[model samples]
Target chain A: MIQDRLRTRMGWLHAWSGFVFGLLLVCIFASGTIAVFDTELTRWLQPEVPPSATALTDEALEETLPTIRKLLERDEKPFITLPSERDPILRVQYHDGHEFLNIPFDPGTGQELAARATVGGTFFYDLHYSLRNGDTGIIFVTFSGLMLLIVLGSGIIIHLKELIPDLLVLRPFSARLRAWLDVHVLASVPFLPFAFMMAYTGTFLHTRSILPPVSYLASINAAITPVAVRAESPALQKEKTVVPALPPLSPLLHDAEKVVRAGQVGFILFLPKNILISRTDASGPARTREHVDFSYDGHFIRHVLLTTPLTRTQQVMEGIHYVRWGGAGMRWLYFISGLATTIMIGSGLVLFLMKRRRLSGGRVIFRLAEGLTVSVLVGFPLACSGFFWGNRLLSGGSEQRTQEEVTVFFLIWAASAVWGMGGCLMKWRVQVWRSELGLLAVLSALLGPLDLLTRSGGTVFHTPTVFAAVDLIALCVAAVAFQIARRLA
Target chain B: MIVLCSVLWIVSLSVQAVSEPRMLRIARREAVAPALTVRLMRWVSLVGLLLCLYQRPSTALFVWLGSFSIATVVVALGWAWRYRGVQRVRRTGGGS
Candidate 1:
């Protein structure tokens, strides 16, 4: 009787917790899953952006400094980041309230090109991290993550009976509870390490929010600052009154390489008064900290080494998060793990509503769950498809390109929500799922060919790396859609 | 020894699943049984030791140590609660 009571309590906790936060958790996971390959997606979407070759020794700051200085003379604090392997544009960013005025420069000629916004990549990034709602979103996500930790704990406790026995078992034809438990175990067990790390790191990420009162008491300035200040140093006054002619970038680059002992210099930043060269070692995988920042005024090296521990820690954290130090194999591992996390969260939500429907015999609750399932599972993909569609449809030189993209996203989402509600009214959960998946497959398959035909620069067949990846992912989506359609039928 | 451990595990699970009020008292007692606690502690320690051995003197060692420390704290809490419960029962002369 006591054991039965304990089981009841556990079941109650699981059901309530899952029902309340499942939908939001699914959104978070799906967005994050897509954002894992955000960079690749950006490249595939935008074909007009020109790729940069390695900056020649001859085309150093001596050649480029004048152009940069001339461009930045009017701005208060101008900065340039030299093109690296991932991004090949010499990006010049001028801070404007919460937004950046980005000017892409030709690495070879040092000529300023037309500015392009980073809305596509930035949107997905922000959605994953902040959910585009700022502090409220952060709080919601953090709370959901905490709840997830509890859910996992309770799940472990509840399934202690069959945990070991059911490790590899997937009873596809079992009752709803049994099937849900099987999926929960299957998804959770394989990526247990990832789940634990995500929880720990996620808590750490939201530490400021969790312990805000304490954090505020500890450091008031840190709590307020938009940009974190790493180091405190005496500002270098302009010693040379005259606008001194800058030294050639080749020598500076050579000197930086010697100091850092790196194979090749990635980027050379020409400040109005100083030149910064970012150099990384060839032996190790790409690390942010490995890229040494050197501030030089022509011949003199003002700052040789990083003076801030905070900056170093931040670099290491970025390195861990970005997995830049990990090669293709490690990246693939992270990708697979992220995919599993998405599946785990998505399936968990589905299971929650499924279980709830069994308990609550009301049509209202069932309809709500069905609508939410459709919105989250179908709406997210449709919104992403619309983002691509917006990119293609919007004129290249149009001022409202960003606005158009956002509009497309909202419109698709709203339409999906309506469609989901309508489907729920008709009790067409399986039919809606099948239909939406089919739509996704058709849209995904068309994306590559559309890009090839519409874009001037390159064809999908020619650039096998970018184009083939898109095609393959699309094909996978199509296959999944076909399977779902079949299952539904 | 393996048979004994498996029997203890099964007993703990059976205790956990009982729903009658009298059975619950027995179950709670079994849940915090010295034999069960010792077995759990040993398994946890073994896992920790193996991890520390595998990734000796590294971050993994620290992780094992941390988990062990947490388990120790949890066991202490469980013991304290059990002791309090027993004292309460003694005072009330097994009323509930």
Candidate 2:
């Protein structure tokens, strides 16, 4: 009886929490899965980039010096990123008061490519954590993550005993409820570690931004002033004088590479006072916070390291969560795992609604909830495809093109949401599911051929095969959607 | 070599499952004498996993995790197809 009581209590907590926050969690996990391959997706989004035969060598860096100098003269804080194996273009970027101006160059000859302005993979990355809402989004996401942790804990407690015996038991031919329950358990168990780590580290990454510990402590301490109120660092106080005839960047980059012998230089930041070159390779879980610092005259200053062990450990955990060190294999794994998480959560949501639909008959609130489930599950993917379609079809010369692309995504999503709610109100739930899923399948299948037809064959074909890979994946997704739509009762 | 180890691991898991009373009694089969093969296979599986870890920890972990995920789906589908067809439940004595 006590065991039954405990199970019942935990079940209530798990079901309610999963139901309430499942959609948001799905969005977060889905975006995060895509964000794992953000750079590759960026490349895929912009197919106009010409192929680069040159590598990120000293000679190539030297070739790009004149343009880098020109950019530096124009912008107060211009930075250059050297191409690595994953990203094969040299990027010179600066903030132009409103947003960023990114100029992609051929790594070999340093010739600029006239790539269209598009919000590449960074959109997904920003969407993952912030939902593009800035600080409010981070706070909301962090709260959702915390809830996820709680839900996971309660779920484990509810099934702790059965977990081992039913570890791999998935009885798909059983009753509907039983089959869904089995699938939920099966999906949750294997990816439990990954889900837990991502939630924990993701929360940690946002903790300082929202509820900074130092400031929180200071608020309680009457005698102590907050760190935010502290005097400006000497680094920020450096005078900005016109740097005429600056030293060459290639030798400085060479020196920086020599200092950090293990990793490749990813970014070169030019400040009025100093230069910072950070490691670009995130091929491992544990990454050192090491970067080469240089004086304004290109003199080697110091190699910065994490001073505290605690801070180092935190950074390593953050690195593992962010996954900047991995190559293609690791990234694919992260992506797949993230997709699995979305599936797990999505299946759980479906199961909850299925189990409760009968009991919620004739209830408006339940119908609304059902509509929401359909909108989030089928609608988001629909909107995403719309975004990609806009990227291909929208004129690049238009002002605020990125914002327009984002607007297209939300418009489709909102329309889908309205359709779903309308259908549910009119008792067309099954039709809504079938039609939306069919639309998704068609959109996904067409995405590949659409890009192929629109892109400059000569340039895109010669470039990295990531374009083809994305298209192939879209086709696969289309196939999955068709299967699901066909199988749905 | 990694593929070999993964196969060994799966085989070992199957062997270990057969030793369970629920599984064996459902099959109406007696336990293997001394359970020697099961023990041996278990050790081999462990050793194989360890070898994977020693070589590439991250890859091994992901592969192992993915293996489990695939195994769950495959086993579930296989069981449903083989035994649950034309019936609501399998003959495992556990009602869903």
Candidate 3:
């Protein structure tokens, strides 16, 4: 009897919280999954970056010097990222207060790439954690993740007895409610370990919001630094700024390569009198914060490879969550897993509403809740595909084209919400919204052809690329959405 | 080797899946999988996973874990196809 009571109580918490947060969690999981290939998406969004990276010659590195100095003169700190497998272009990047705006340069020709500026895949990455709202968004996502863990736990307790037996049992032709329940269980139970790992690591990455660092603490009895020393540092910084000419980078990069593992120096951070070249995150599980430093005049200063156990643990956590250490194969695994988890959350939301429909179907509250479901589930993906449409359709010469693309995304999403709410007010059928919006996304039907036609069509056949996979995936999605819309109708 | 380990994971899970009576029906057998076949496959795949971990700890560990995800979906789809002919699994009630 006590066990039954506990299960009932947990079920109550599970239904309400799962429905509430699962709506948003679906968006987060989908965006995070796509963010797994953000760099590739960024490349797809920018077609003019050239098909291959030329050798990282000193001449190519030197060409970026003038541009870097110009950025420095504007008091913006700039860095140069070396060509790597994922992205084969030398880039001059600087933080433009909102996002890292970059100028791509062909590694071989030292000429600037005419790639159009779009938020790119980083849009999804930012949306995943912060909903693109910055710190407050991060806090919201972090807690939503925590609530997801709770929902998972409660769900386990509710189904503990049948969990193992039903772990792999998915009966798609079962009763309507049962079929949805089976999908929820199938998506969740079998992938519980992954769900748990991602939720924990994802939240851990942003724990500072919950427990702010020492900077949050009052400065009671804090030691004050000498004002003169503080003033001296900026004076020294100004001196370095004045002496902007840099030493030849090719030789320095060569020496730095020997210090880093596999001789893969991914990025070069320029200093007034020094340069810090760091190891690539793609090389290993522990992004060990390893680097080699050199003086501006080509003298080796130090090579630092952090090996402390605590740091290693942190690095592994980041590597696991980020999935940057492994090759393309591991990334696909994360992407598939993330998709399944999103399906699980989306299925659970459907189940929650279905289970309650018999009891509260007539209430305004239920109607609004249904609208929210449509907004997130059908709306977000609609907006995602629309962003691609905007990328191709929006004129290339438009000013602030990045923001324009993002605005297109939100507009489509808002339109979905408007239709959903309108349906709520007019008592229009759910199937109408589902099939209409679902078909209208065309499930991103033209994405592949759009990619082929707009981007230089040569690259598609010549290279195995992220854009190709995205195109193929969108086609699959189109087929699936057609079937779903057909069935609903 | 990690690829082999991933394939082995699917094979092992398939072996266990056949242990269920519902799954056995797909193989034209009324009997469940032999206890030994299921146990042996499980042990073999697990030990291979451990050895992979020992050799290339980071990649091995990640691949080993990731295998479960893909394997689950693959096995589930297999189940779906086998059960495709059946409709209304439960006539009047929800799933257990």
- Show the colliding residue pairs in model 1: A1-B18, A1-B19, A1-B20, A2-B18, A2-B19, A2-B20, A3-B16, A3-B17, A3-B18, A61-A249
DockQ of each: 0.02, 0.33, 0.51
User: Which candidate, 1 or 3, has the higher DockQ?
Assistant: 3
lDDT of 3 by residue, A1-489 (tens): 999999999999999899888988999999999999988888888877776777767789888988887877776778898888888889888765445667899898788888887777888988898887766677789889999999999999999998876766776765678878888988888778889989998888887765566564332112133334555775445533564567778888888877775447878887656778888888777777688898867789998877789778788878889988788888887888898899999888878878888998888888888888878878888888888889988988887898998999999899888888678756775564665566554748888878787877545565456677889888877776676666652
**What is the TM-score of each candidate's chain B when compared with the real chain B?**
0.39, 0.58, 0.66
Top candidate when judged by lDDT against the true structure: 3
Q: Over the stretch B1-96, how does candidate 1's per-residue lDDT look in tens digits?
A: 222223333343333323223333422444334456544443434444454456433233324433332232233234334455554564467835
Worst 10 residues of 3 chain A by lDDT: A218-227
TM-score of each: 0.68, 0.85, 0.89
Considering summed lDDT, which 10 consecutive residues are worst modelled in model 3 chain B? B87-96
Q: What is the lDDT of every predicted structure here?
A: 0.58, 0.75, 0.78
Each candidate: RMSD: 12.9, 5.1, 5.0
lDDT of 3 at A485: 68
Clashing pairs in 3: none
